[model samples]
Target: MAQQLILVTGAARCGKSEWAESLAIASDRAVTYIATATVDPADPEWQARIDRHQQRRPATWQTMATVEDLAQQIEGAEPTQCLLIDSLGTWVANLLDRSDVEWEKIAQALLAVLPTSRGTIIMVAEETGWGVVPAYPSGRLFRDRLGMLTRQIGSISSTVYLVTGGHVLNLSQLGQKLDR
Candidate 1:
């Protein structure tokens, strides 16, 4: 059987994560929430944000922190399980210090693993390119890399959802996929 791939993307605070969680709940399979953002105990705001997401998840769903690596975590999942990876932007930002060449390798590895994973995958990604071009070189790199990664993921995804203003649009149904 082919594994399901779902991509949910939106601006920050646009309920992207919540929407992805809903899809996971609807899957009727054992769900695992993979938090890509590393928990920083010292940062109160970040801690609170993580707490809110944790509180929102159903207790029946297991949660995994991607301290090892997101690709590895997904690759290890059971075929019958559902994996919700909330926010790819953070994952990109976390490794922003890497050179462009290194980032490409990382992104390629992730793309390679997504389709081969045993479980259903739902990814929440922030649409950062819709705003102004970033001033800093690093910021620009982050936006560009994330945009490219999201596009690649969307290409392989069976379903792509755009969440904004509490509305969810099924891009896979409503829009045309651009060939790279």
Candidate 2:
């Protein structure tokens, strides 16, 4: 089968990660779990959350911690390895932190990464635009930019999934039933 890009999106605390993990495990190709989450030493809650995620993933899965240059990492991936990008929301947050970055630039970077990927790629991202607007301009900007990014990614993805309340619903016609 040709390389496929699947975009999985959902609200925070939803089972996006679990679903993505399931997809990766089911695929016969070698799996590469690209984690974008950086450890925050001062935040115990975040650290705990990361630990919980680590406990859930299989030990056999190769993990790569790529905080920056996500596009570079994705672009450099071997054609034989299936890649799981757990959460684009964190990547967007990191991009927002840089004053020189632009939304279109980020979107283009992501688009460039997917076409060259040889194996299946499943991306997980938070669905944050459905909720109340944030008071801060930057927060709102992030939400808006994320919405745009998701739409763009979904356009190129062969399959798109939206998880809510632990239920995963396929949004694309090429969808195969996912065993949750």
Candidate 3:
């Protein structure tokens, strides 16, 4: 089977994570859920959300949680295992302290490594641009940075899905259909 880089993007709470999980489950290879979310024991709501995500995943699937070394983790995985990265937004959020240049460097590294990655890769990202503009500068910065990262990843991805209100749009096909 052909390996694919699939990008699933949508607004918050639009079932993007569930969709990515479904795709990973459908893959023939072993699925490794590369979790980027940081758990805070002090926050009950955050803990509950994390618990919900954990419950949705299959028991057999391996999970690695790390904000950094994403590339290294992906590269070290077995060639036969599919890697499902749940949310790029969180990963980017974790690195907010880095300068734009530093963030860009990381993104560039990811873009370079992903094309050569062994197994089918699925990534989830939030489409935050559709909402109202952020009131604060940092929020705007995060939104803009995530947007740029999404475009870069989507451009390299074999297929891109835009999920909204329980619907999914095949962006690659849509682009072609519209061009014609």
Candidate 4:
């Protein structure tokens, strides 16, 4: 059987990334940290956040930093490679300017590769729907798209963890699946 697909999602600063990292560290496969964040040295706060994440990772692991090649990177992973993708929201935001048709194509391609993909895949996602509705069209678009993507991924994931308030809840085991 293929390894379980794990998803760790939560609000900002809720330790979701750390939880996902722990999962990767526990895996026997070679861990590869797949960063979806863009490197913007001009933004000190963003750079600091990235630096913190970088400092947290072990030197033995390989890091693939890319804003656009996430699906391709996942497709290229070795069967024994454990990929810890430290976010889905950043990746979505990076491509927010794409047309709806274009975005759908990209999303479909990613969904296609995920189902039968090899190795241990642990994804870190942000929960975006719990707050007030976005006030702008672009913001709404982002929230809807991300919400859809996470729900779809969560549907297929073998384990779904919701980390909030310093608590990690295994939604996959504790909650009922929503039938579409």
> Best candidate, TM-score-wise?
4
Model 1 weakest lDDT span, ten residues long: 65-74
Give one digit per residue, the lDDT tens place, for model 2 in 115-162. 777778999999876768899999987888778788778877888999
Sorted on TM-score, best first, the list reads: 4, 1, 3, 2
Global lDDT scores for all candidate models: 0.90, 0.83, 0.87, 0.90
Task: Kindly state the number of residue pairs that clash in model 3.
Answer: 0
lDDT of 1 by residue, 83-162 (tens): 99987998998889988788888888899999998899999999988878999999899999899999999999999999
Error of 3 at 168 (Å): 1.7
For 36-65, candidate 4 gives per-residue lDDT tens digits of 998887899999999999999999999988
Stretches > 4 Å off in candidate 2: 100-103, 174-180
| Per-residue lDDT of model 3, residues 1-180, tens digit only | 368899999999999999999888888789999999999989999999999999999999999897967777777656788899988999989988899898888878888888888888999999887788999988998999899888888888898999999998889888742221
Off by over 4 Å in 1: none
Error of 4 at 45 (Å): 0.6
Lowest summed lDDT over 10 consecutive residues: which window, candidate 2? 171-180
Rate residue 60 of model 4 by lDDT. Answer: 93
Q: Please identify model 4 stretches exceeding 4 Å from their true place.
A: none
| lDDT pick, better of 2 and 4 | 4
Worst 10 residues of 4 by lDDT: 1-10
Winner by lDDT between candidate 2 and candidate 1 = 1
